[model samples]
Each structure stands twice: as structure tokens, then as C-alpha cells.
Target: MAQPLEPAERRPANHGPKVAARNRDALIVAAREIYATHGLDAPLSAIARRAGVGQGVLYRHFPDRTAVAIAVLEENVRQVEQAAAAEDAAFADVLGVLTWHLTESAAFLGLLHANGATGHTEALAHALVLSGRVESALRRLLPEGHRLSAPDGLMLAVAMVSGAVGGPTREVREHRAVAAWRLLGVEVGPVRPFEG
Candidate 1:
């Protein structure tokens, strides 16, 4: 007699709220790595592969590349807020956090300014919230004479750092950020060593 046939094991559906949230987090992390290595135009499939999820899961969470980028930016802003909230954190420390993100994810800021960019308003609005917080910190920490007089000063600082992302290497980018602070008449004590 022939051997009996066995039933195939069934997998759980990837549809619950917990599963959705976990998949979204994984996608964001994977997107950050993929975009950093290959720039924003890198294939969305690559991100799904990196996250070990299916294409359907990726689209279910992000819907598009810009959505993934915005999630990454939102995470970056959380880090900035955490750093800013520290009791001993200085304006320079906050900028250090920003520089770290800039070097690691160079193309993120560019997405905000790209011509015909889909998420310009959303990204800029999110960035402006951070800008307001940074401006408050700048006013609190900067010397009277060195303080930026205009309302948009920190946005200018951000623009400077945004410009820095085009440098050849992470070190060059960090140096450019420091140079940007110097141009703004603020001194960042030392460039934080790159860990990425």
C-alpha cells in the first residue's frame, strides 16, 4: 500500500492590529536602511524583502515610498524631542541629534524639497513643528548678541544642515553641519563620531 498523504501546515493571517503595527515598524526600520544605502528611489520591494515581509504587507502599511519616508522622519523627530527634553541638553546637543539623522539618512530632507514631491506639505509641516521647538531652545541657550533675531532662524539652520547632506562622506557631512552652526554664530563643541 502507498503511504498516507499528510495535510499542509497553515500560517496565520497578517491582518490583526498587532501584526499590522509590528509590520509597519519593521518596514520603517528597513526603509531607513534601504534608503540610506540606495537613496529614496530604491525599490519598495527591496524594503519589503529587508523587513522579511510580503509586498502586500508593505503596501498595507505605507501605501507608497513617501509614506515610508515620512514615518522615518517622524521617528527622527521623536528622537530629537527626546534629546531636547533631557535636563542638561543644549541647543548644540539637539543639533547633534539632527546631524546624526542627516548623515544616516541623507536623502530624507531632500524628499521635502524635491520638485513635484508628493508629501511636501506634510513633511514641511512636520519639520516646522521641530523647527519651532529648536527655535525656542536656540533662544534659551544662545548668547544675547548671537541669538537669531528672526522667527525663521532655526529653519535657516535646518536649511544649512539640509545643504550639508550632499557632502561626499558621513564625516564631511558632520563637518558641514558644524560649519553651518559656526556660520549661524553658534559653536557645537565637537563633532560626534559617526557610529553608522
Candidate 2:
């Protein structure tokens, strides 16, 4: 699958920052392009052209660069949360999602951590809720001790994998992920028998 365009920052000479919902999709696409090209330093004019809108329209939907960036970050988080709802998710499935996120979003992750949101980081906040629900469901599916431990264990496992590696490619990432899973007391793959 092709990678989605990342969101960029834009601050033209306006303050309208609230376009119609119809224009939001286009603006978001353009913002991703601008951000991909220039990181946080992308210009509003470029994004406007990409979205086929004016400076007023850009600001209409996004008051400032930070707001635009945050919106994009939220969108990305929404995508991640969606993936977390798979019916066939396994222990490795959890690692796969975390692995994908770490590499694809190291930069945005830092930005999000630094920017405090009272209740506006809806994507992540939604994630907290989703996680609780998923854990509740899985608690019935896992082993005894593994039951109560899942909620926190799953979250911590992701953190461990993320911390151990700085988002390596899938092949390398899977290896680290499997190792972390073992460290968390969940063994994956067939064990090699040895004669002592």
C-alpha cells in the first residue's frame, strides 16, 4: 500500500481558519503535500494551490500552522485506531500496528507529545477508549494471568518495541517486535528443541 501524505504546516496572511466541511478534505490533501515537501516550514500559498483554494479558504479551515498540523495528526491517529479493531488480531498483530506507527510517525509523535490537548486530541483519546474495550474483549480470550495483564501489557509492549527500535523496515521491525513479545512473556513461533 502507498503511504498516505503527511500533514504540513501553513500560515498565510489571514485569520478565517474555518472553511466549510466540504473544503476540508481538499485542504487536508494539500496540507499533506505541503508538509511532505517542507516539513513544518511549508508555505500556505503552496498548499492553497495544491488544494485549489485561496489563502482565506486555507485559514478558514485552519487558523494557524499548529492547528493544521494537529488536525493532520488527529487524522493519522484515526487511521491507526481503525486498524486496532481487527477481528483476527493476534499478539503479533499488536506489534505490527505499533511497528508501522513508530517509523511512519516519529516526527509527528514528538510534536503530539509536546502539544498538550485538554480534550482535543480526539484520535488518541478515542484510542484510549478503544483500547479499554479491546482489552475487555481480549481478557476473555487470553490465558489466566495473561487476562488481567492485557490492558496494560498490550500498551506497554508497544512502547517497548517502539523504544527498542527507531522504526526499522518491516523485516527488521518484525524481528525486534517478536523479541519484545517474548520479553513480555508471549512466545511466538516454533521453539527449536535441544538435547541437553
Candidate 3:
């Protein structure tokens, strides 16, 4: 028979702040990988194991699966916020970056969308706040005298980008970005692929 693992061997090293921080970051990274591959329904224990942390550490960082999902969405929102606030950022660039992040986060987004209608009020509220932040950023980046409202334009862009998430080609993504711009009444030139 195989030897049973020791308690210390099964859990992450509890060295200090550095170790704690590392464990936290690892959890997020592992959560992203697991969710991307196995989807939102993947077990929390799988996430802890993937992070090389025990269930205790995972619970200390995120009390529940919803908390973990929210943290991931928050990180995604932060990246878009930073890009949107750039001094020389163009609408196409913002759209491209948002699309890239959304594509990578499609599973999480799907979970939030499903939760929104199934009585997960906290998650739904967080999703709305994040969406509002993106919409506000888009409004700030819009050229003067734009026709579509920011919310309307953002919805169209989000829908288009979400649909293109599984696309295999850069051309497809760029094409969707261009279409999004057109929906907002802007005739943007060719869109460059997002570096992130």
C-alpha cells in the first residue's frame, strides 16, 4: 500500500508574510487555471490542491467559492480600469484589452451571469458594479459627440466580445472589435491585438 502523506506535507509552508502572500497569489492563479479548464463548478478542494495549499489556507483567503469568483472578477476589472485610465489610450485599444481579459475569463463570466438570475444577490451586485465601472471608463474614452449611450455601447461591445471568446484567430477578434466600434458610431481603423 502507498504511504499516507503527513499533515505538513499536505499543506503549504507557513513561513511568514512572504509565504502567505505567495499562497494567496498562488490560489488566485490556480483558481483561474482550474476554472478555465473545468469551469465554475470545479470543487474548492481542487483549487486548494492546485495551489499547493490546504483547505484551511483557502478558507482563510476566501470564505467561499463566491468570494474566490468575486476576487477573480475584481482582478479582471482592475486591469481594464488601468488600461482605460491610460493617457494615450484609444477606444480600440481599450476594447481590445477588455476583450482579451473577457476571453480569458469567459468561464467566470458565465458563472456570474448564471448566478445573477439564480438568487445570488451579492455576486449579481458585484457583477453590476464591475460592469458599471467598465461602462464609465468607456464613456470617458469616447470621442466627443458620440451617438450611443455608454451603457448601450458597452452592452453591444460586451456581447460581441463574449461571442468571440472561443474564436481561434486574431483576425476574428479584431473583426469583432471593429464591429463593436461601428455599433457605437465610431469608424475606427484596424485594431491591434491586445498584448496582455
* Model 2 per-residue lDDT at 91: 40
Q: Please report how far candidate 3 places residue 139 from its true position, in Å.
A: 1.8
Runs off by more than 4 Å, candidate 3: 1-13, 145-151, 163-196
Over 4 Å off, model 2: 1-22, 86-102, 113-152, 157-196
TM-score between candidate 3 and the true structure: 0.72
Residues 16-78 of candidate 1: C-alpha lDDT, one tens digit per residue: 676877888899889887887788789999999999899989998887766777788877666
Q: lDDT by residue for model 2 over 44-100, one digit each (tens)?
A: 778788888888888878887767766665555454444445565454444344454
Q: Please list all clashing residue pairs in model 2, or write none if there are none.
A: 8-35, 17-59, 17-60, 18-60, 18-61, 19-60, 19-61
State residue 174's C-alpha deviation in candidate 3, in Å: 9.3
Q: For residue 176, give model 3's deviation from the true position in Å.
A: 7.3
**Which pairs clash in model 1?**
none
TM-score of every model versus the real structure: 0.72, 0.48, 0.72
- Residue 110 of model 1 has an lDDT of 75
Error of 1 at 13 (Å): 9.7
Q: What digit string (tens of lDDT, one per residue) describes model 3 on residues 1-196?
A: 9987788767866586668888987898788768776777789999999999899999999998888888877877777778778787786677667766665565665655565665456766898888888788877887775654554755665665565454434445456655655655555433432334
Between prediction 2 and prediction 3, which has the larger TM-score?
Answer: 3
